[model samples]
Target: MSRHRRQRGGPTFARAATLLQITKLVEFPAVFLSSIVQANVLPSRQYGQLVVDLSIAFIAATVMSLGVEESLQRALAANPRDRAIWTEALASRAFVGLALTLLAGILLVCDQTSLAIVGCIVVANSIYDLVVAQTASLLRPAVPSIFNIAAVIAASSATLLVRPSSSISCLTITLIFSSLRTAGCVLLSCRLLKPVRLSFRDAVRMPNLADRGWRPLVDLTVYRLTNNILNRQGDLIIAGIVAVDKTSVGTYALAFSLTTAANTVFLTGIGSMTLTRFSATYAESGKFELGKSWQRMTYLTAFLSSWPLAILIAIGPGLSVILFHGKYPGLALYLVLIGVVAWLGRISGGGANIAVLFTLRNEKLVRKVFLMAAAMNVATDFVLMPLIGMYGAIVGTMIGTFFSSRFLNVQIRRRTRSSVEWSPLLLLSCLTAIVTAPVALLHRSFTLSICAVVVSLCLWATFSWRSSICPPEISSRVHDVFGKKSSVGTD
Candidate 1:
């Protein structure tokens, strides 16, 4: 009887993990379509600042999150022996939320407007990340949909009240809704988890930050930090490095906003599931060999995420010209580049699970790699921004991401039995480039020969590669997730 119960519940656990991954793919359109609606409806200045704000806010949250939420989430899945660890992480994260607010307030008091604004973003970010971390780890993936639906509703409501021709109020509406979305998720968490009442003392007592758990915490922070500078810092730097002209910056923001939002769906959605699954696997087996299953999933995601970006890079400018009536053609290029870059970025993210899995054993070594990556990112940004303009920001991203992928990232991943499926990315990129060239030349045509070819190939590649793509566990897990199930993902 006990064995039967375990068998039934086992699928549930597996399905929950898969839901976390699918949520990203399933939710992609929601984010992209919503951004388009908001882009068409919001004032340019507000929209630019909003992009910059969200960008900076994420970075701030990284600093402020202090790895507490991640700690809790992993403990929830992989380490139930210390139940108090979950409570402590939650408490520490909450306390940090307060601290982030205070930190933001100080910058505001000093009249550091950018920093102050960054502070607000951080506070919002901290709340959102914690809410997401908790829900993704503790509840079923559908609960996350409740939060997404709430965000969609809030964003749509804001759009209805705002218009492209309206004033900056549109931007404010968008930001408000984003912040409120975090609050709504928290409400759902309360209802679902009925999380035990925890106090500051209990949270603080748990050895969360610098203890054995600190390894994952440190690796995540530095890795997140490096990515932030490469990706997030681009917007703010645009305002300074090349965005000295208000209208120009605003135009770029319009395009960049769409790409970032869409990419976030994939990054945020799948990233959590990957982290949680790998972390749990690590806890159970202490084997990096298990991550090989994820390597298979990586191939599928790389193929799936790429050509759309290639197509966008091909068609986005024309679409922009028609959509916004040429509100900003330059932005179209930014969007395409960002999409391609994000797809490239995600191709590597599946590998990060190794870092988390190995973190406990290689904590100090992992920290050094991330710190090194961060330093390179900052140095490159400082040196390159003056040279290539906003595009240079992406150069930093490419460089940093490349460095991480080739150097530190690979080393850590080597600890696991899994090897990076580097061929697909190169193959996809080359094929995409070949296909896109003709489309670019045919700028005047409504239909792109290059885009058509790319899309057809993308579909083929995605489907053709599915069986060849996932590792045994990942394939089994994915099937488990999408198939009929009664119990596991019900949470």
Candidate 2:
């Protein structure tokens, strides 16, 4: 019976992991579509204002979250039946949500109507995000993802139908759709996942963090918040300081959204698979196998992400015009510059550290690295944005990512005493250079650019295969396809 259980465990885990990956990847299209529709349909100023409001709401949600979601996931993983902890987390979240709501109400008196509406949705989404996080930790992520997909479709359809003509109308529609999505997430959490429902009694009881230690919770929360500020909050930063003109903000937002599509669909979704594999590998062999696993995962992610990113940097301008209806001039150039910065950010973004540290349960180290990185980000943004306009934010993001990646390396070495190899990134950079240089040297001919990309990808694949960086399955298939040719040619 035990043997059967072990056999079943492998397949079951794989299935669940696959589902989660699919969920994230599938969610991307709906999200990207919604952004596209919103960008095209709304007037430029309205869309820019909407981005600013949403950004503020997200910041509020991050604060009000109070790190409970991360703490809850860890606590539940340690003791799944610990109802007290679950209740405590739920109660804390409820209180924070209420406080935020009250603050939002006060904003109405202050005439910050847009922010107030956004605050309501933020509160709802924060709870919903917590539930989804819980479900993912419970290894049944598909349930919430299903509800998320439904909500997105419904929201997008409604937004499109309404075609909000003004900023206020758009904000109202956004609030309504966001609330509906939250409701769907909550219902699915209760019905499908059978979450521990927290009563008013449970909602008020605070946990004693002194006894259990709040280090992990604080580390993860600060890391996530700071990371978001650096990477994902560019539109907000532009709205606040970098670009005062709504059209400029709107243009940057549109281009950034396009880059996010690449991240969501390809880079991030695929990256999660490595985290799962690393966790299992560490559990089985501890630090002995972790170094190699980390290296392989990093190389694999670099290989997978390099081409699409290079493609984006190469063809982003033309693609932007075609996709977004050419509302903003110079958008293509903005897309290219942002795409390069984003790709650099993605490659050097320290997924290996995240996977390894989380596996080692060294949350404190992770937190410290991110905190420093966040500081670097803030300082860089302030200096650069004042000097270089919107490009300053992009440059700051790139530099901030470099700092974070460097600190992550330092932590990994202190713990494992092993150095991570840079050959993979060097190789990827070489490939990108090969692909993009010709396009820059030659005049803007779409056909030549496409040929350069295809040829560069072929070269990259061949080089990776020769270097043994290609996965075993792909290598095997390649050998089978080419083996007969080599033998026949020799004859």
Tens-place lDDT per residue, model 1, 427-451, is 6567676666567656734576454
Model 2, runs deviating above 4 Å: 1-21, 33-58, 72-113, 116-145, 192-211, 232-235, 270-283, 436-462, 471-491
TM-scores of all predicted structures? 0.74, 0.75
Task: Please report how far candidate 1 places residue 210 from its true position, in Å.
Answer: 5.7
Instruction: Give candidate 2's error at residue 299 in angstroms.
Output: 2.1
Number of the top candidate by TM-score? 2
What does candidate 2 score on TM?
Answer: 0.75
lDDT, residue 29, model 2: 53
Clashes of each: 2, 2
lDDT of 2 by residue, 1-491 (tens): 43453353333433443455566565565456545544443334354565676677667666666555544544543444455565555455545655665676577678666676557656655655555444554435666677667766665666566654344444455455455555554455345324566666555543433465767557767777777777746435544654445555556666677776665554543443445455556655677677766665556566666776666656655565565556676677766777666666545536776767876877777777777777777777777766665666677777878777767767776776566456856775787777776684554556666777777778877887777776443455567787733211100
Where is model 1 more than 4 Å wrong at Cα? 1-59, 80-126, 129-137, 163-171, 192-197, 203-210, 213-223, 238-248, 349-363, 432-437, 440-454, 457-459, 462-467, 470-491
User: In candidate 1, where is summed lDDT lowest over 10 consecutive residues?
Assistant: 482-491
Error of 1 at 372 (Å): 3.5
